[model samples]
Target: MPRHDHASLFIPPALTRRRLLGGALAAAAVGATPGASVFAQAAYPTRPVSLLVPFPPGSATDAIARALAPQVSKALGQQLVVENRPGAAGTMATGIVAQSKTPDGYQIAIAPATVFKVPHMQKVPYEPLKDLTYIMGFSGYTFALVVPESSPWKTFQEFIAYAKANPGKINVGTSGAASTGHAATMRLAQRTGADLNHIPFKGGSEVLQAFIGGHINAVLDGGWAQVEKQGKGRVLLAFTAKRMPRLPDVPTAIELGIQHVARSPIGLVGPKGMDPAVVKTIHDAFKGALSDPTYRRYLETYDLEDAYLSGADWYALAQKMWVDERKILEELDMLPK
Candidate 1:
């Protein structure tokens, strides 16, 4: 499936936390070999767990992690501290988790699309499918193309027209180079014949600061909901398959006949070789956290979809996404020579 497949994520029927935990126990019983560590098979997560956010503070992923940590901590009977380790377009912290000698459930990070996409673009420290244990996918973002309200372009078409006329003169901003927003903007340029110049920032807050200060003509990011609410900018295009309910007036890139659709699925992942019992404990805790009212409201705030998939299912999806994203980068000539 392409990156635009909003409904592609596998969501199973709801199951109670007890049932989920029971299933995990059964799996652990079957998967355990002779002489396996009794500690690994014992009641898991005996201490505080560290949830690392790859993006900087104030990022969407960071907010989601903070929202989920307390709820997960309550379920696991241990505190889940959210640590900010933002860099390398979200790959640095992920590498830290993947490279850890301990496969204990205490250290985990939020895996974004970049987790898989970056390896294909350039050398990375970890293999997406091999070095990490995918716990669960809780949410995915809805991205948009936002421009200052005072700008002359009133719609996506007008913006494209201006870009077409100006060529590389139209400066577009994203959270970072090769990020979901930057890739989507590049794909849109390919499909529309608009030579849009991409400007990368450290994070969404920085991107917004540059956009608001008129340093860039437009920004494609998930952090535009607040900006649009302040009436400082207008969302010209939603880089989603369907129009976002929060931005009903905004048209989607697909609606405008552009085949480019970008979404960044967020999930929890630990180091490779984690115990099945421990994986289940973390997954069940976060599964319970997914329904938290505050977290649900946070999802709505950014128009993010509730993309829940079990550990096994998310691992399979990541395998497929690795292949799919590689094709996208190859097509864009973004891969190294």
Candidate 2:
């Protein structure tokens, strides 16, 4: 993925707690009367904010978070620090954010769509929809089914047919159990009635490695833009509603007669019990950041599409995704015992 230039948006080291608090108090005093300003300086994020990525540092989610951090920090006039806390298929970091002491907008998480799928596969401490305040939905990357260019299966249908005939002989790679890749593979198996074997890795890079090393027959993973560009593999199909502009030749799952699309949409979120005012402030900042030209360029470079949504809209989508994921997991017999 392309790294966005953050020099222009870098937070000054001179930004101190005293200055931030003083600015907040002044804004509060000025806005003591109702209907003062939506961008009231005292509303929320009185200090540096931390955005947690529930995946390892170089993962797609982590890259997106880092790309948006400086822009968000500039928009909010506060430093946005990104912290990696990968474990338990993202539940561990999400659990930490859900249980954190700060709901004042100082702490937030970059939530992946996989968070909705994980609960069906294992015990999770937080409800995907109810335990967090959805601040904004920014961008999403499409999942791709990739195999070596020399593989015998040329198209998605061929791969499905081969898998059906071979049963558990064909192995597929995923980032982790309940990841978007994993859920998508399971759903594909259920839809096609193929008894394929799944091999889980810690991240997309590893999944690609397994596929290249011939340890896995195919990889159902994100970062297709990166993988396909490497020239060693070909994308069998995209698990998206439409063909990606960069990969125009690749067919989508829908185009291949499947009714599902599994892009890993990510967004900003805070722990439950956040003040509505704080949520609004954070949402506005991220919304602004999403529109920044630099950010837009980053999206295009990574073959990611912009899917901006407000807090309410994102929350509704999250709710629907949770329900839909549960149904799919149950149908595939992947629900936890």
Candidate 3:
């Protein structure tokens, strides 16, 4: 009986090489999906991470990424690459990142408030409000109205007066037709009888370029402040209720008796199903970056606020805004339904 018991100690003859292969195949099948790897998130950022900017290089959005990238990299132990995939008024790149299946915290994007309305406006790839996971809030655009330095209009009043006297002669450029800038511009025209000829461009950079080249009389964009700061364009009025800090001398639309604003809140967004822990890690890194002196300096330099919010808070705000913006989009005749 003891000799017979040696069978238990020896390898079972039934466990042939083919059986071993079958066992391995079974294990691999189980490991195919991310859920199968319980510790996948705990070991994140094994390689360089991308911070996708939905605007061209030298843009304010691009500036945000570049300013915070080094600090975020130091916090995460990996390089946070600022990659620009500019097009479609900052939606093309956003859609690319939102639809990304890589949930390992390697791909994320800076989503602007325009995303809220863009989807309802027309058919797009991703539903920004639901499709992407909001990570944290960042600074918003300080939209303003500016004219070339050599333009005849010296003040906001003069511009409006001229517009009233000359109906469609005032040509204005914006990021796009349905862009926040364009919408704000149109709202201004509707309110003040500007009758501005709105010229839509692909991005704010183009709007600014056109304005600088004297292709347009005025440009309604966030980049207007930079042009004013650079002494290229003269800011006539801020679209917001308050004057932009960088252009403190400039009058607000409210001060000029125009009740309007064009501030577009922006935030970080990743593909759906991102691990909570990974999101928290990214949020904390960005929070730290927002607080960094250099980054803050950049924000101030660009006339931007460090509007950082916790991941939970940011998501809540996005959801609430989604509901609010839907109504506005509908009123603007930009709803799918």
lDDT of 3 by residue, 199-243 (tens): 988777777888889899998887666787788988888887676
Give the Cα RMSD of candidate 2. 9.1
> Per model, how many backbone clashes are there?
0, 0, 0
Candidate 1, residues 1-337: lDDT per residue as tens digits? 2232111222234645665566546545323211122132346777899988887887777777888878999999999999988777677778899888787778988888878787887777766676777778878877899999999999988999998888899999988887888788888888899999999887777788888899999999877776787898899998888887776898988888887778678788887666666877788889999999888877776667899987767777787788888888887878899
Clashing pairs in 3: none
**In model 2, where is the ten-residue run with the lowest total lDDT?**
1-10
lDDT (CA) for every model shown? 0.78, 0.72, 0.73
Candidate 2 off by > 4 Å: 1-46, 212-214
TM-score of candidate 1 against the unseen true structure: 0.87
The residue-by-residue lDDT of candidate 2 on 1-337, one tens digit each, is 1111211222245656565455445433211111111222344566898888877766666777777788889888889998987766665567787666556678788777778888767676766665666677777777888988879888888998998888899999988877888888887887778898988877665677777788889988776566567677888888988787777898988876777788577777777655445666677677777767766766665567788876667766777787887887777688867
Clashing pairs in 1: none
Best to worst by lDDT, what's the order?
1, 3, 2
